[model samples]
Target: MPPFSLMRCGAYLIPLVNSPLAVAQTTHLPEIEVRGPRDSSIGSADSASEGAAERESFQSRPKLRPGDIVEAVPGVVATQHSGDGKANQYFLRGFNLDHGTDFAVTVDGMPVNMPTHGHGQGFADLNFLTPELVSGVRYRKGPYFADSGDFSLAGSASLDYLSALPAPIVDVSFGSHNFRRLLAAGSRTVADQTWLGAIELEGNDGPWQVPEQLRKANAVLRYSQGSSARGLSLTGMAYQSRWNSTDQVPQRLIDSGEISRFGSMNPTDGGRTRRLSLSGKWFDKGRDGETQISAYAMDYRFDLFSDFTYFLRNPVDGDQFEQTDRRRAFGAQGSRSMPNRIGGLDGLLSVGAQWRGDRIGEVGLYDTVARERLSTLRNDKVSQDLVSIYAQQFVNFSDHWRGYVGWRSDALRYDVQGRALAYGSLNSGKGHDAITSPKLGLAFTVTPQHELYLNAGGGFHSNDVRGATITIDPQSGLPAERVPALVKGRGAELGWRFQPNDDLTATVALWELGLDSELVYVGDAGSTEPGRASRRRGLEATLRWKVVSHWRLEADAALSRGRFRGEAPEGEGDHVDNAVERVFAAGVTYIGGPWTASLRLRYMGPRALDTLNTVRSRATALLNFGARYAVNEHLTLGLDVFNLAGRKGNDIEYFYASCTAGEVASGACGGGIDDRHVHPMEPRSARVSARWTF
Candidate 1:
């Protein structure tokens, strides 16, 4: 008889049973042994802290935003600093990440990070994602893989969507603060091809004096043929959102009872954004080996109005500023893998290439009040291009030992054209650079249930083109120093994975990373600042246990230290500001015939807020609970409770000097006085949902 196996599609694992004749013909074939959970042991050495999460893991979690889906990765934390329309703040391995500067994110093989973005470099916004279509998530927590390059110093994640669904589903939800949402998704097969479609509509009025009236619309369409390993697919997506914002407030104002914690300094603060994209992928498996190719094109627009200093810049206009970004981007990637034999030993060789480009029509900053632009501070057009090629070889020296070596080279070019504005002509220049990264990995199988691994690699992150050749600061008109087009990173890891039983899996890793230099473009100032080189070391541990047939438990913990590389002068400290030191997460999940429940706790530890360590941020802990009950074969009801403990904490905190109405004359208005700026966490909230499957 032919061999049979199980294939996972969405939340179902369907059995692929073979016919009697086929099974009888294949009975003489060699036996294949699949190891570890979901074949996670395939490349134990090539990646440290890398694995996949099942669909149930995502469906069971209580998430407020689509970006929260990334929190499924161990030791990864996602937070929000401003409006709901913006990208979530991401932190991993002691790096602040800052809108995805060090970490890379992708959805269905399409890159999510925007290079040279008006708000920040490598800005990654996940608002467009439809969580219901997600099939699985694959993540790696180090720069130990050759396939990932730019913005992957801290780690990388790839989210995949199901090509087909078992049935159509319609979900409607209502919650406190006037929150409402509706989603419809389904798939159909015709002429040996599968087509999938989804649409989502959401609206909310947050608990704030300004009432964050957020409205969003999202849609997706996909067509595919064959299986994931050898299939062709085309996907199109659209998303749009607009919302009012309640930005962080000064602690002095809140402490003096001048305003509430959820009060906004500028009621006009808000943003609008839209994205349209088309992507395609093709894969083939033949007698020789396997090959895969992908291509994508995208159009995006963003407009934001913000006021942080609240009268520090223009006392008359109240320090409100507007930022605008519009761009078109395209990219392509292809790879081929082939089996080989070396000295009577089995091995594999892979080669890949990628090319991407972005044409930004308008990236501008303007002084504004009440959403009206007063004057343009800077305006320019940017064109950026990147090309990379990589090769890797994996060899099996023996049954218990294996190793891999990889090399990658990347080339980048930047071109900027200034738009003459009232604030003087913006700097226009062109620059290009190239870098080569190498990776090495080794693994040893100690026993059937235990494995050890060691990995070392190099990675990099690109800088904004405006910061690479600017001669004058657009905000201050002072001489501005240019930074390197690409900053290099080096990292190493030692790890172990153990599966004592079918129900228990554990992993532990110790890693360290160093950077050549820390240079970032300050969006608020329209200039680049050079920071000291830094080093980070950390330890991460994770546990997954299926306690029973209907219950599971998961726990993860991470501790890290970050500091400047060189010695500091008198009165100076080596601490890295905003670098998180510790993070912990635990969750319990239950799945039965008609009832499901989940409870989760997340903790973020305190860290320094200033270069001198004189100021520090307070730790925060939050609890969330969710439950779902199936009413019938096609009906289900669900409820989620956020901030279950009703803890009073801040979502984010920073120490900086700002000016206010009463403190302008005391030498503490324009950068003299130091006070904490805080964005408090949202209080307890509840949401109820009903889903119907057809």
Candidate 2:
């Protein structure tokens, strides 16, 4: 009776004592056992917290840039206050996602934020990303799913790249303030088609006292033919950068020593950027079920100079400011998925569409000093458009129940011209908005491993069609009030999941969100201000383990609370300013043989810098370390350590009002006064790397 069959290790199905003609006359076969996912309920919510740096569970993780790869997504928190070519400061759950509104970032399907942005309002910008050609990162947080639209209510991330590459590489790195880097990558397949290439160069001068000197460049090219779920692809990208900034400083000028603590109230504060892109993709999965298509184009540029109120409002050109952006973007998307039954219940159906456009010759705001430009507080020429459509359904009336429903619709258009500047007057505008988002999910499979979830959603974030059509106030011509170009959101979630074997897994969530106004688009006060209407609540937890067979461990934690939905003043206190209350992260990894190691820790808690919370911010922790060694087989060597205990934190903090240089004002000579405004943290750094393969 040596004829048996059934083998599928992961969700269990073992039983194969000998089959396939007794294992083709037996030469060896018998010994298999590797488990996980016995019933991880693949239906709704949770399960998509991924990362890969060539696997082994994140290859000794440690990243200093490339936006730190979204911090591997567990409660995300990336920060940087000035130049690193700008655009990092993220933080999640308790909001404060300023530069990227409520998250949503993508690569490969293109679109990385940037909606009517010149700086602030969904401005994503991962410095064009090279990160060794990524190759995996998928994240999800709130706003259920429905293909997530528009800055996705506090969640979203998708990055994938790597059509080929198993060898052919060169990498070099050196660090500690004078940092330097170079990378080159390759892949090839010739006639059968498959090519990929990459290039990158970087430089840094950091540890500031005025010496940021940044500078970077990157490039990539790709072409593919098939297989990756059936495919065709083409891609190209380029990036450039420059820097010099050390903004954010004033805790009474480092407590009156007048500057230090990585000082710089403006040191010609700086920025410069550029990006170019082209993309294309097509996919098909036969047996009557899947199809996908994508397209993209982009060219962008930005110039920035900031001085977060060093002298409060042009106290003789010291409140420096200048932000300029030029853009051209295009997009397209399509999708389809099928298999259905309805009445008899058994389903799956998906449909999608998306389109986007932006042609902004310039989105400006200036009033600078050492960097030129002396006035001109708003100058624009923007044209924006977006359209979306979606549908989703997934059901399985049994096997422990499952459900999902989705709908999405969005349309937005805005055209603005206005540019006469020197003193206001020269306007032209238009606006239109629409939104419909609905999503629901449910799952219940109480055994086999455990699962339970319920989610609800509706989301939106869009505003700044010149603040939905302003009429004046290009820096005070007065008479300005206009907002609402789509701003609505509501969310809820309750979840739990547990995988009891094959190396553990766990998750838990409880959430709530609401908003209808938080009116943004005040690029340094060029308009739009009127906010209040918010609510948020949260709790999240996660853990993953694989404590043997090479070891691994991870952890996540988050807690939140935000407010602002009614009264304040008298002693203030409605919180919601900078939200963010408690967050924690942990990591551990070790791979034997050729050796690899990792250790990480992060925490950022305590936030509230106004609304009479009497200023708060003091809880930031960091510890990082990484190691790699393999000096044989194609060579390799690596090391990274940052803040490993040098901890003297403060990566961000703000409370406003500035007057520096012996303040005492009644008007002019650096007026306006109130304290705190840090941005320290960076001392104990190291990096060293070398890799080669052919």
Candidate 3:
């Protein structure tokens, strides 16, 4: 029996057995200390032991890029290989991360959406955030807080820089994929005044065969003094990361989870940006109150080649693609928290308001073919402006319980010139839409060693007012128009936590979510239609224990099912690529004299190919192993290997498709017809890294 066949058999057989794999609690964990001072484990794979077991536990150190982040996360999927590592996209909450701009992204309280964007993921360039530089990542499913207003559909990713540390520090790393990393930060503390500065860089040829390459750099600086000094502070951060590749690779065959694709898929895509922020804080003594205000702005540009025609054999027949975009933003926020007795309960009230707007362009500046450029965006200039107001209050319902509620309203305006194309007398105009989002949660401690909780929240996203005119139905001959559709997200969860023994703790949670205006495939290049509400409901459970000194273990698993609610007719490209069935994770840690090691395993069920919407995966399980040694109190060495046991993992494919015809396109091609199958993951790649304290 071959490994793939065995895996297929286990997929069906394992469910029959309640106890598929035995897992114990954890006592000691591999401490891969991150930006924080404590030697705590970093990375999403090394989730913390708090909260819900598997479904929504706070995971740290998750991969930062689209491929690594979305691939490992549950309830999300992506398209596979495009030759030379080009055309990498993700199916997030069932939508393509393709255009880049649609899915909202933010870093340290700043938006990444561009001023103008088509109906895809091109504008949302998260590659700028290097995974290693990230101290921690918090992925909140469904609707989140108002501060994250830009994107709340597929949840959100919150990134933070190192906090509460000295002004100066340095870090460097070297790994597989021809990877190298460097970080340097300087800070000064003079009594009540403090100063900080830092720089970071990550470069790699990317070890994968796609022959892709990446380079990233970042800088940060801050200055602050005592409260009397205008209660003001200055902090700024900037980043630039680029991806270079040949484009798409076509897939042809698969066996034992490894795929063989022939033909070439080629293209090029990447982005760059700069951001800055300034804030003020004031504490009132007469009445207990804390307030903060912020002013911020960002300028970014993205360049891409999504035209698969680049590899159509005949240079004239190929579609050369490129979109140059620049986006800018300015905004302000004010909030006040006051301590008081609300209905005999001690709590606080917070409220604020803000306004923002952007000028965007979808210009087809240059392309290999002139006709393709004109057909793409000959007369494309769409801009949007928005203003909003919101308020939230936190209250203590009882000694062991707390709750919060919030509401917001928004107004919008849009501009465009149907010059390149045609529009019925529809002129640039303003529109208004508003919704009140609310959140409520409770925490209960039944006993000193046990706790229970529940939470429910709502969020909204109206379709882009700009994309309504990309391409009218090629079949209908009707004028192509992109209309903004109102979208909403709602979720509820119940959970419990228990500590039966000193060294063991466990968490169990049940959750369900609904998202409106889902992007359903409409069949055609750069085209899609909004579907009704989709439901994401599932169960998550985890068990962790420290059986004894020097030995620790943890187990976690999640089962989610997502689908269109009305049983709507399935189109050629209609599919749910989220982790519909199961995702399992387990880890073991061993600490010995002068040496420590840990082993981790992750199992993911199959998914549908985003493009053709076919269920094709054969199911896969990936194993990762890591070990480290202490050279002394001041230094340590370690080896970490992803895909241990040399298991060749398959590709889930990001949600978009495009091709290129660069010089390196020959070796990059794989599948024939859009090469649905991507090459398997590398057999086994390992990295040795270390750190020292002075």
Winner by lDDT: 1
Which candidate model has the greater lDDT, 1 or 2? 1
- Please provide TM-scores, in order, for all candidate models, with all chains considered together: 0.92, 0.33, 0.74
Candidate order by TM-score, decreasing, is 1, 3, 2
Deviation in angstroms for 487 in model 3? Answer: 1.2
Task: List, residue by residue over 1-694, the lDDT tens digit for candidate 1.
Answer: 0111111121231111122211212233233221112526533535548887656766798898899999988988888878889888888999777788888999999999988887778888999999878777888877777889899998888888777666567778889898888777766665447677777778887888998888888889898887535789999999999999887789889999999998888899999999999999999998799999999999999998877777776655667888889999999999999999889999899999999999999998888889998878778899999999999999999988899889999999989888846433548888899999999889888898888989999999888877787888777878878888888989999989988776888889999999887643332442235577889999999888899999989999999998888877677688887888999999999999999999999999998887688899999998999999999998999999999999878888877666776677555576535788888888899999998776
Q: Provide the global lDDT of candidate 2 against the true structure.
A: 0.76
Query: Model 2, 298-413: lDDT tens per residue?
Result: 99999888877666665555667788889899988898989888999878899999999999998888878888988777878889888999998988889887878899999998
Question: What TM-score would candidate 3 get against the native?
Answer: 0.74
With candidate 3 superimposed using the best TM-score fit, by how many Å does residue 170's alpha carbon deviate from the native?
A: 4.8
Give per-residue CA lDDT, model 3, range 618-680, as digits (tens): 466777676767788756676767777776566443333433343226655333234343445
lDDT of 1 at 550: 95
Score candidate 2 by TM-score against the native.
0.33
- Tell me how far the alpha carbon of residue 85 in candidate 1 is from the true structure, in angstroms, after superposition: 0.6
